[model samples]
Target: MQAYRIDGVVRQGKTNQDFCIDLVAENEDQVREKVYSNFGSRHGAKRRYITINSITTIDPSESSAPVVVSHFRDK
Candidate 1:
């Protein structure tokens, strides 16, 4: 798996909020799918409400999320 940084905006009830999240996926397309599923379950957010602006492939050291860091560190 590779570490990715996903930046985007989510609309909920007339409110739009920006979001940045770190995730591990095999590719950018997988990252998008994961993001959509995660947001859907956690926030009751639909795919249409989520706007993914950028999907960046980042080095392990550059990751801010501990889980991502740990996954790479342990490997």
Candidate 2:
């Protein structure tokens, strides 16, 4: 497993809100799917409403701080 940082925006009403999320996944595809599922469940957002700008692998050392982490399970 690898840590990934996904940067994107989600449509909320008439505006788009930026988001930075960190998760443990094997690849970028997994990261994208998790983001869609997570935001959809939490905010009632559809896949079309989410726009992923970038997905990058995160160094484990850089993730040692006290940041909120999200755990995703593959469906």
Candidate 3:
């Protein structure tokens, strides 16, 4: 698996809230599905409301310092 940085925006009410997520996945398609599944379930948002702006693989050297950590994880 590879680490990917997914950037996008989701429609929330009258606003479009931007989000960035870092996760481990195999490819861009998997990244997209994961993003949609995560946002949809966590925020009760529909797939149509989510817009993926960019999907890029993270270099291994930079994975040591991720920009956006998952808040859902236990410390």
Q: Choose the strongest candidate by lDDT.
A: 1
lDDT of 3 by residue, 1-75 (tens): 677888899999999999988877778899899999999889988999999999988754454434323422233
TM-score of 1: 0.92
Ranking by lDDT: 1, 2, 3
- Cα lDDT of model 2 by residue, 10-51, tens digit: 999999999988777778888888899999999999999999
Clashes of 1: 0
Cα displacement (angstroms), candidate 3, residue 61, comes to: 4.3
**Which clashing pairs does model 1 show?**
none
Put down candidate 1 lDDT per residue, 1-75, tens digits, no spaces: 899999999998889999999999999999999999999999999999999999998887888798798889866
Root-mean-square deviation of every model: 1.0, 5.2, 5.0
Q: Best to worst by TM-score, what's the order? A: 1, 2, 3
The deviation in Å at residue 45 for candidate 3 is 0.8
For each candidate in the order shown, give its overall lDDT on alpha carbons. 0.93, 0.80, 0.79
User: What's the true lDDT of residue 15 in model 1?
Assistant: 96
